[model samples]
Target: MRMSMTDLEPSRVEPEERVVILDFGSQYGHLIARRVRELGVYSVVLPHHAPLAEILRHRPRGVILSGGPASVYEPGAPQCDPGLWQAGVPVLGICYGMQLMVHQLGGRVDRADHREYGPATLEVEEPGRLLAGLGPRVDVWMSHGDRVDALPPGFTVLARTAGSPYAAVEGGDGRWLGVQFHPEVAHTPRGREILANFLYRVCGCKGGWSMAEFVERAVPALRRQLAGARALCALSGGVDSAVAAALVHRAIGPRLICVFVDTGLLREGEVEEVRSIFTGLGMDLRVVDARDRFLAALDGLADPEAKRKAVGETFIRVFEEEARRLEAQVGAIPFLVQGTTYPDVIESGGGAAATIKSHHNVGGLPADLEFQLVEPLRDLFKDEVREVGRRLGLPPAIVDRQPFPGPGLAIRMIGPVTAERLQRLRACDRIVREEIRRAGLEDRLWQAFAVLTGTPTVGVMGDRRTYGEAVAVRAVTSDDGMTADWARLPYEVLDRIARRLANEVEGVNRVVYDVTSKPPATIEWE
Candidate 1:
């Protein structure tokens, strides 16, 4: 059927050479797993209570014990299978994970009189294989309450900090290792290099997994699912929804209905651009302009969650009506596809971590909506999704499109979802993007957009005092959305962006740049 999502029966991705991470209920566990995968190795995180037999089934070349919130001596503290170490595989434990290992191997761990919660300096005493060439003193990130009182037999202290006598240890002739600090976090300066060293030098792992490999495996699996069925994908013009719909189009061919609901809250020229991009790929794209209806549903709503939920319900109604219209033309379309990623699932409380926010597509869907959901790129990150899109022959315009939230500019409007405010924010957003593109910084940026704070500031325009809405220009640089730093844009670019928004955008008089990082203020203000 000539498809862009392409075809293949996904072959097994090295269960033998994989690094199996044991999760002990730490929020950082998944981050640890992601760090390992970024090292170009196949890695998976299993529940802390996973059976010993299940652990052996992966036939892992190495194992990592993730940090947890619980102390090692708590009554119901999570514990690894004692046989886990007996498996004779190399292991590296972090934080609570390190404490658990010490207790298991006949060492004492107790609550410390002084708990280390942030940064600490480590003095590398022995410079063991793990700490080789790490210099005389290493700055490490520490977040733990328990300290190892004594080392287990046959273990040597590689590094030590002021708060804890033991910070890093090595035993079993370099086969076993533990660290009190978390190397998965960005706060730890040498985290990535250390993980890479473990993967390449210690475990002797060869990375064979790529996003292209994922594409080959997923295409055929999707084809098998939609063999004779007609599926409808919800298109948001963002990377996730676009990639999801395009992949399904490659599988189902003419049997796919790609519905794009234009809620009038999208950026300038977005609706037209989206339709043109999809149709250029020979996709059966359907554009539904239910913007008035969406604004109507969100009328008088001020809270972010309330506005998001309203938008979600309205989107379902629009899609349902669109589905009915499509069903009339083509016999029946039953499957509904979405590009809900792993971070979305985890942030929406579908993973081990608590709910951070409700994504409109994943968590904001109405309970009574009537369609089967199909998400092909559910497990990939944003960068991974872009790679799959490239392999599917999607042009850079779509593949490299900066990620937009599911609720569109409705969430960015920061106030009532009226057409007036939508237009203002859209204009400001357009100027921000145009200036970034003009400076040739668009490709390097993670996201660059204008967020309307819905607050007005006074300005003198041609010697006349005027009050108008203020827009904050947000630009960030990030490998993933998990953590981000504000992009240090050049003064020339910033000056141009600010000057254009004030001069060109009608209702915008004040333009401000957000300098806060992700830890304190999210990239998206709302």
Candidate 2:
């Protein structure tokens, strides 16, 4: 594999500029980081109370206070560390972040009689430095019940809406800016442009944070981290793990062992594809045939969550056994590498409640295990991981693999998993993937999976009434798995998938497409 110039760059070398986002438990906190990345600048989402020393360690060029589900007047509402205001970096606050900024700086906020929860028109009262390029009047997305009644001593209200008296504020010679509306969402018109203005004008940040640079910088650090340490990576054949395994291989060569477990719930041909890719990469590889183990452990499990937990726990037990055996032979315990990404960490919320999903990496680990964890892709999002994969010279087939749940087909099968049901769903899912690929839409989707609804529905085939399981094809496009919009598959593509699944896959009499986005419906029904 040929190495790109960017791949040779030092990973620890900080970017020319970065945006630090102080997360306040808002769902959009990660979205704020995504927006900054889209602007060609690196961003990290830290907890609201992250110490000033930790923030300074990143040497961020600017800071962003993310919106949250908190009211400034609430007694226990999240607050920023006092040292943040004096951090000397340009700061932009959104929604609750704005309210917190005001309240912290000696301003007053109150619950309003009329609350804005959707689209609103902001009339610019004063075109301050923050609103220099943004026009006089614009539309923005608003979702808040509280409003700032007054600004801090030196801060001036930059804009206001019908219901909000202090919709926007600027302070500290434009070093500090706050907006009552979210600029990260597309619904807010001119949001990206506004963010760009902040990046270039306010922060004076250089747009050097590209995936190319990331891969170049990360490789050597990954090499050092794995030096003299044998590593075992979980290869799910999905893009995340594939990229992770490939990158680690590039960094440490034979010291890295890629383990691909056949969970029996994977779609048709998935195991072979994973094996072929790892072998092709010339890395030490192990293909564990644990299909029966997974199926037996999951036998009679009807609840989706239960099936998921069972699959996760089973994987860890199997992996732990393998790790111990490998260690016994190799005379040293290896680092257990996982493809855990930022979205997983953020959605899991860095706390107990967020850790509900039995992540095979952290959640599934037994308390008695002793191997150290190695997660190279911990800081990257899914898209960035793919770019790094491409830079590492991995095959497009592996690098562009769609997102698959760790529980595999277990979660996709809505009821008790059975060999017959697995076959039916795999066939249906293959048809959907083939159709999407033929339409040249593979790269446009984050995930495209088929689910066996388990419930039999009445249908007619060959003029005969039949009852069989229903299959629903779900495809979504998302920057991060935190939020997603259902992909709008072309009618022809949908028609082809549905027709093929019904006609080709046995026990599937109905085929449907999931049109619901995240929130009302998660990407995975289970």
Candidate 3:
């Protein structure tokens, strides 16, 4: 496939050198691309069994084999086309990818006597191209049952753990590298540095991928794709959808109609923000304040999953109505642009077809919907999306907005959904967001939102005993939503947020910060 014209621009990060991450049914496969992008190089993630010709067409500078839950010894384990290794691109095999590399290269692997599931220390015996500059011992996050027992020809074991002899290995020629642990996740100490070393030293890839280049390239392509057809985009006011809508408008001037739905569960001032952004962008926009419709549909829903399903279904219904209106007004509506990212596809269990979370556009579409979906950001990560936004001249506040759940505050309410509870949570969440922004930690924190726990306890307010709902503040730092760590917020910052929420927001007694990470706890309480 020929590279798109948009692909040939001087990005903040250069696109000349790129990495292709081949997904092998791993949950964290997309994270690999995200890590690489953070290093200033562009990357694309493809399915494990993607054709070698398809991969080579992009002309990637390097390749990464992601760790999957599959066992390489299994008869039907996911395998790449043999031609991939011969592409001459440097290959980095991770976990299951390492096992597959070993087995394919004539090495031996077997079920370990003891599975390594958590943090483990690895001793680097011989550091070379991959492990250069790293100390002799390093802590790594490991999650594997099968272990590499022997090295293949022309390969040397560079590092090892107590249970696995071939924890880390390198091809004698130094082009291929393998590690049994996942360096893409933060729980693995020095994970970012490990990935940085690979992109800079081993692959000789320069970190030149930037969002500006994406916008310069993508806008024109989008115009071409939507030529003479009416494109409708679902605007959620969040950064992803906002950026997506902005890019679409840039692509097809006045041909894109942005539909903003007031789901009734959004944060404070969200609807106004959406309107301001769309109007400011000079987009052909329609604001549908269907707060009552959404709230009625979500009435009596207590389960978080059920709430999501209800909201998603209702959104499709509203979208379909708008699409019908557009068809009657404009005579034709053929495309529905979405803000779906690479992580959404992977978490939906790429290839294996496991549904992690149903995106409103992906799984929430009604059967009777007529528009074909157009997802431009499907191949890009969140950070890349932000870059594209910056390139498109979006304001910094809108471009760097934190990740919000699709169901909005509906899912943040721990107990039954009520207008009062929603309002309270919104107020509390606003305070937290304001404090973080004031502290200049907004960009560093992935998401920082307040959850309303219906369970209330007694507290003293001005010497008078009172009982109210307890709010919990969840602030996490993450590359992709798959794995995350709680942000180690400064004590003063946390204190400021808590004090403001308790004093300003009514009906809240206590405030707490979530210390848990992704493994034990997801970003959202519900």
lDDT of each: 0.82, 0.81, 0.80
Q: Residues 269-342, candidate 2, lDDT per residue (tens digit)?
A: 88787777778778888989998998899888898667766876777677777877787678564576778887
TM-score of candidate 2 relative to the true fold = 0.90
Total backbone collisions, model 2 = 5
Q: Give each prediction's root-mean-square deviation over alpha carbons.
A: 4.8, 5.0, 5.4
What overall lDDT, based on C-alpha atoms, would model 3 receive against the true structure? Answer: 0.80
Give stretches of model 1 more than 4 Å off: 1-17, 22-30, 46-62, 68-90, 103-106, 110-140, 143-146, 152-156, 170-176, 185-190, 200-204, 458-465
Candidates sorted on TM-score, descending: 2, 1, 3
Candidate closest to the true structure, highest lDDT: 1
lDDT of 1: 0.82
Per-model clash counts, in order, read 0, 5, 8
Task: Give the TM-score of each candidate.
Answer: 0.85, 0.90, 0.82
Which runs in model 2 stand beyond 4 Å of their true positions?
A: 1-17, 351-358, 460-465
